[model samples]
Target: MAHVVSAMASETSPEDLTDLSLEQLLNLEVISASRLGQKSSQAPTSVSILTANDIRTFGWRTLAEALNSMRGLFTSNDRNYSYLGIRGFMRGGDYNSRILLMIDGQRMNENIYDGGYIAQEFMLDMDLVERIEYIPGSGSSIYGANAFLGMINVVTKQGKAIDGSQLAGEIGTFDTYKGRVSYGKTLKNGTDLLFSASHYDTAGVENLYFPGYDSPETNNGIAHKMDDERADRLFGKIKFEELTLSGGYVDRGRHVPTAAFDGIFNDPLFFTDDKQFFSNLKYEKALNENTSLLLKGFYQGYDYYGDQAYIVNDARVINHDEASGRWWGGEAQLTTHPFEGHRLIAGLEYQYDQRQRLLNYDLDPYLPYLESHRNGHRVEVYLQDDIQLLDDLVFSAGARLDYHHMLKNLQLNPRVGLIWSPLTNTQFKLLYSSTFRAPNAWERDYNAFGFVDNPLMREEQIKSYEAIAEWRSDSNLRLLGTLFYNDISQLLEGHLTGDADGNYALINAGRFHAYGGELEAEKRWSNGRLLKASYTYSLLTNENRHGAWANASPQNLFKLHYAEPLFDNYLSLGLESIFIDSRKNGLGGKVNGYELVNINLSSDKLIHGLDTSFGIYNVFDSHYQMLGVSENIDVLRMNGREFRLKFQLTF
Candidate 1:
């Protein structure tokens, strides 16, 4: 889809990207993909950015929707939760603990479950986001933990960008209603602040049917009047010179429609709740022309609650499960350019988990099943360097060491990369990296109702090697290619084992290997008209038979986005499409391919200050399914066609 760049953006403008020379385009600065800020052409890894203009033009409400448009990535929704599948590794029951999610360089993954929310439940509203950067590959070398598959970095808008107060509203299909109020101010003293609050609600999917539970005991596999969702969000930020403060909070609830975990089907009483609060203060100082220092302190709290209805003791009853956590951390970093063609960056971080707790009980009979509480802490240090041997050759390397109370040994991760600009319009890169994910509170302590716990479980490890090439022609055309090989070992998986308390325990099951490549091409015009397409091919295998489920990720993925300006930039129209190929499922069956198409129209000044957008999703209403397990419902069906209309006004 087409996107309109605003004056407040810090990224390279569409005009510059389309009309500028190759040498000028190579000077754009970017962060997140590499902790050290560097030019886009020199960044060690592959990076993709989606700006606020794109978000508005595409009419995307959730991060998941925006991610679907990104290359080498896709998400599968089972009506209960959405899981990110990266480069052909989509585990069925995972909580997206493999991908690290960050808001302004701060980690968002919780300690209790090692989970990151990317759906409507995400902490901040989409309107407050300035840009989203997707970094594909292992990242633990600098982040220290939970950066296995990929990483997502979200940058928020500055107060000067908003300028004043704004109001927005939207009413869409499925009775979805949303409203927001925001204010921003920038004083003459170089102080700026932004505050916003939003509310959203929807009566999602009134009824649905499942064929897996077609017995009289489970309401004949039908779910009715049980799909509803709502959320309230608050966010604020302030900055003055070298000091900055930011905080955010969110509370979300969703009604279960799939009757998962053997819960009663068609019941309206099954639901889940998520709440989070985070605050941080940061300071920075430039000691000299080529050296700087940064310090930050942060606090975070989280709570998760769930209620499921079940047939217990020949009666309808409820199972209540809850978890809450709190933690505080601090970090210090220093950067120096001590000599010519040499730059070095170093950092140290410490985090203390104040409280990690989980509880399971019965609401109908007033009984307690399990209660677990634990405290943990972590320490980490890292260093990275960049060297420019020649005008056309560059080398980068980094490593990190981490120590955790629950982990028996210290973990060390490392990364190395090389970049060569053979021609003014062509660049090549080679990279190698290692990352890991440690066991979380649930995996280490909670054996609540039926699952077993193995405290001896270790961290999961990954090693990756990749080669990339990017080329640009004089006609404003771009071509890019990337190939990678990933080896995953010491994977934590829950298997049916004859343990004393239950039948399932988490252990280091086996090894998995994957190799894939992505190809993309794009053409752009001086008028902001864009046409882009990409294709992906992957072949994934494993050392053991049980790891076949990881192949749920599509073997072939095709994506296209096109847009054209009409009526002298007053109106815009765009189209998007995605095609996925069949994949081998865990049950020895093959899941068929599906294609989705979307169209949208928007006008910026049709009514002067009133921006309007209309869109249609899933135009063909194709039905596709994803892999599932016993604890979660399979035979799940995706959403059909839907319509959206939105309006926003600024003062």
Candidate 2:
């Protein structure tokens, strides 16, 4: 499968791009890199793209699975939630707050936690995605906040892409099952509409063993039927001419088996439920060949509920936790060519957080521990210009000024990039950028029995520098290499204070530094053959602390992906392999690293109006462990081999 669509045109729709030639796909335009439609090679930062074709061929079940195949990116799951790791910067307990996630240019991060959901909790089903654009490095100059490391943009398929009604069903190992129904079409009056709904359920691992709870009373370190998960999602979109409306909703529930947060082991009462919803309205128009205008508004809401069973005074007690968040925002952007050699982009953005609520208490006794409600707003303005300094050189510069209500302060972020293309097929870039992440409400105002609030916490800041080189051949072969350095300050870390209560608080810790390098190569053949490989090396450390900051970040990562047509175009096969170096866990113990291989066989032409696929994940059944997020849990064992069979019918 071809991972990147080089045939994408600047203003063309996804359905139109499919009809273009391979050469056009090689120059595919990316929007997440600079909020503008520009070729990936010409973008201000390093970018990677994946299309729906790749997802179908690889049998990717979730967004995280698709993203994990990219260079310098990985994900870990504790059987409850998934976390994203980028270039050795993933920290234990962090809720993926540093990376920004957008769906069709609408921010999806909630107001309270600022977390990007990538697992089953994600709003859109994988089948609904048209393409995903990943831009690495500091992106605050264009995006206000939560773009500390990188950003992701998910583009949904248009109604015309589906062109009809569809039904899909899947059955996987461990009693997992899923079903989806969708309808889409383009009306004769130029109106486009699409709607989809899906439901998923999994019994999960039957006998999950936790070494920390080995007593007989705790099921001898084994948890039975405690890792179950269920999710439901709905998405809809409509478009007419230049105006578009879209919305999505997801509700997910997962059972915990690790006894996290001091929960009772082998108890079925430990579970978390998450729900998110968003609606977006957008308008776009081209004033002329050299000018374009865009305006958008969005509303988002999030809710979380959790129950943890604990032993209080030798009796079983249940603790209830809940949070609710709601927010609305708007943006106006203009892109124009001020002169022959310059392209300028300017935008204004505003957001109002209407509600931020957190509640925690004990059941049965009706004892309250914490209750808080707060609201805030933010405003930002940014400008970026790309100038053709010379025939073979391009200079890009941008900056943003933001006013945050919580901080009561103004922040300025800047970015610069210089690209030199000495040869038509070769280019080199030097880039520098700075970004920040504001402390969320959960980290600032949630004071509870086991946690304390820090209202005066400072925002985390980072500066990144990168040098990149890329080369592409006419035969659809590409090679890329990059070296990067990141310096971070005032990082927020949850630590136990010296107080007698043993309460944990979020504090602005000392500085951290990371340096890394990445190398990648990809080649594609016209006969449905592709090969891609990437390697990453990183060294991360804390300047103020002596111990290793190896939360979940690995030092070395290697990935490979291959796809080929089989049986004279009747079937397609995909193979993927990944290797991660060993890393130290949160408890100062080393977690052994392991490799994983996955295979998938798929075909869309085997039957009329039907698509079939079979996938085997973790083919080797490597017993790996990922760092745990809770203080009571040191490491969480990962899943073994699993199989899935799926079929889709279109009418």
On TM-score, the leading prediction is 2
lDDT of 2: 0.83
Q: Which ten residues in a row have the lowest lDDT in candidate 1?
A: 1-10
Instruction: Write candidate 2's Cα lDDT for 1-651 as tens digits.
Output: 001122355556676533333345547776722443367777767777777877887889999998888898888887788888888878655668888888877888888888898999899999988877787864333575888888877888888888999999999999999999999999999999999999999999899888777888889899999989999999999999888998999999999898887889889999999999998888888899988887888888999999998999999999999999999988888888999888888888889999999999999888999898999888888888888999989998888888877675788988988989999888898888887888888888878767788877887889999999998898888899999999989998878977999988889985788899999998877777878899999888878766456556689999999989998978999999988777777677767787889999999898989999999999988777787656556777798899999999999
Task: List, in order, the clash count of every candidate structure.
Answer: 0, 5
Q: Score every model by TM-score.
A: 0.93, 0.96
Over the full model, what C-alpha lDDT does candidate 1 score relative to the true structure? 0.78
* Alpha-carbon lDDT, every model: 0.78, 0.83
Candidate 2: the clashing residue pairs are: 6-24, 6-25, 6-26, 7-24, 7-25
- Candidate 1 deviant stretches above 4 angstroms: 1-27, 32-37, 139-141, 215-220, 500-502, 546-549, 583-588, 629-632
Top of the candidates by lDDT: 2
